[model samples]
Target: MKFLHLISIIISSIFLLNPAFGQTDQWPKRTIKFVVGFGPGGANDIVARIVAEGVSKQLGQPVIVENKPGAGSVLGADFVAKSPSDGYTFFVSAGGIITNPMIKKSMPYKEGDLVPVALLAVSPSIIVVPPDSTIKNLRDLIARAKDAKGIQFSTAGTGSTPHFVAEMLKVNAGGKYDIIPYKSGSEAKVAVLSNQVDATSESSAVTIPQIQGGKLRAIASTWNKRIEALPNVPTTKEEGYPQILIGHWAGLFAPKGTPNEILDKMNKAVEAALKSSEVQKRLVPQGIEPTPGSRASFVNFLNDERNRLAPIVQRANMRDD
Candidate 1:
């Protein structure tokens, strides 16, 4: 009986300690978690799902997107920032990540807590109004803002891209208007459609359908070139307002301290996914131009973007909670 007990212990110890005993090199033995800083059915969610589907197939593991929307996307971002620094947990963050720290004094995690995995894509903002809005174009909106008794604008949220755009427009257009912020771009769009507000800075994804359905009218796209999706709309620069270039972007990130091999493997998967014809085709119609680059390059770009926009964001006096 004593000899049998010793043999059983040895077998149990070997099974527990030696992975090579039966396991193969399955890198992703479980599902990967892709954390999105917004709810489902939005731009962030769409991009996360598209990339996750492709990456999951490539890695032979599921890449699930968990939404954590609130406090202008800080909730989801902080979740990813505080998550274990394993390749299994990733963040599909955007300009909101860098801007959040500047807007609020106390963020859950600093920007350095996150590491870039890849630069996924970008979508520019557009100025759109309700179908029946008397303010037909950018000039008219500016004029009304300056002359009207109580002009107001709607934003996705305070410190969001649209909020910054409206703030900057207030400064450059030389007019102070009432500011109302909603929880999401869709809410802001609804406000505009209902004529509760005058204008908004929204992505093509949010505005294009409304424009097509005659619920809203897109006056200008805030990109350097006319978006292929909205060919008829002119760029803000072409319309003579370069200051209207607020845009939205999405990228891949992992919490700092992620292993190098995992990052490399994940990045390769993202690169392949972004370049896939299906993603390109679907995204192009939504005004997103697919541009994939290296992790190092993405990190450098993030730092550069942070530096370049800090002064402007500071000047806007964006802040709090």
Candidate 2:
């Protein structure tokens, strides 16, 4: 009896001290769900699906991409923020999540509601004009905006990153511009294509097709460097408005209370997915560069981005209420 009691205590100690014990080890015993805050077939959804497939294979479990698009992605974000912290659910969204609270009057969740898991990819925003538009370049557009009513520009939404890019350009280039808000990036592109707006800013991946098809002329990229997909187009830096550098990114996040162990596993899974040949091949050509990193790095990146854009949002008095 004494020997049996000693063995039981020894087994309990091992289980308590070692993570190889049981609970976290059997973690993804079921399907993992990636909650995308955008509709299907869009940039966010497509990337989520690609990464999800690779992650599923890497973890030897089924990872599903579920779209919960609504309210400029706030709905999906809120859903994930309130989800169980069991590591089964994740929120994959654009950098807008960090900026939304600053720009909106009422947000469903605070910044601390979610924790960063991994940095998926970064895509720079491109300012484009229709093929026939007289606005030849960024300088020309600024010159036009310096006039009485200013130049008209359309974007995905009022408080979206594309809108912020336009606002940043207006502030740095010393001019005013009329902003027209559309429901989606596609609509903004259409506004420019139909000459309804003088210009529009969209993700490089989304605008590349139009630029390549000669439907739109690439003016400038809202990034520090020229986009490889559109090598001829200059960046905001080259255009002399380096302060306007802005790039949209997608990343994974979980509810704030999630376990660190699970977060680490998810980050590893995502990094492995990003490194796979399949993910790289699909992302690189579309101007979405994979940027996997540790949880600390991702958190720091988010903090830096939020700080950088807070001033812009405040200066413009931009609110999505």
Candidate 3:
């Protein structure tokens, strides 16, 4: 009886000292959810679905995507930030996650509430107009914006990547346009397609198909290099607007205090999913680039991205409203 009691105490101690030995190891026994702060058909939704499918396969669990669109993705971010840190709920965050706090007067959840898990992918914003519109290029659009009536530019929201692009044009190129906010990039794209708005800067992942289908005309890719899917489209730098460079990047994040073991596992799963041929094939043509990196690297990347955009947001006087 004494020996048996000693063995029981040792086992209990091991589990207590390494709680992950039990909890983290058995994690995700049920369905896991990837929350997207945007509507369907947008870049965030598209990437989340693709990665969720792959992650489900890798983890042997049903990984699902749920959209909670509003307040520039704050709704979804807050939901995830407040969710249980049980390795079951993760956030598929865009650039807005970093810029929202910079622009918004108040955030429902603190930035530290969510911790980075992995950087998944990125897509440069593409300045596009309706196919039938007379705006030939970036310069033409800028020239048109100089008119007294100006032009209408649609965006997902005030702090979204498209909004930043629009602000960049106004500050750097002397372009003046009225920003029209929509629920999601998909809605903004529709506004441009139906001629409700003159143009929009949307993620290439969301705009490449429309451009290829002749529904929209690509004016410039908002990056240093030309998009692989739209090689003919000039970059903003080539169009003489070097300051207008930004892209929408998606990263996985979990509620703070999540076990490091679970975070590491999720990051590995994401990296594996990104390397799969199916994911690459689907993402590449959409102008999305897979970015697989460690959790620490993702944290560093986030810091760098925030630093880079802070000045732009300040100069543009961006606000959530």
Best by TM-score: 2
Assess candidate 3 and give its TM-score to the true structure.
0.88
TM-scores, all models, native as reference: 0.87, 0.91, 0.88
Q: What's the distance in Å from true for residue 243, model 2?
A: 0.6
Q: Which wins on lDDT, candidate 1 or candidate 3?
A: 3
Task: Go through the candidates in order and give the clash count of each.
Answer: 0, 0, 0
User: On residues 104-196, what C-alpha lDDT tens digit does candidate 2 reach at each position?
Assistant: 789888878988899888888888998998888988888888988788889888678779888898788878788889998888889999998
Q: Candidate 1 — which pairs collide?
A: none
Query: Which residue pairs overlap in candidate 2's backbone?
Result: none
Candidate 2 versus the native: TM-score? 0.91
Residue lDDT tens for model 3, 249-304: 89999998789989999999999999999899999889998888899999999998
Score residue 192 of candidate 3 by CA lDDT. 96
Pull out the clashing pairs in model 3: none
Candidate 1 least-lDDT 10 residues: 18-27
Off by over 4 Å in 3: 1-22, 26-28, 147-149
Question: In terms of TM-score, how similar is model 1 to the real structure?
Answer: 0.87
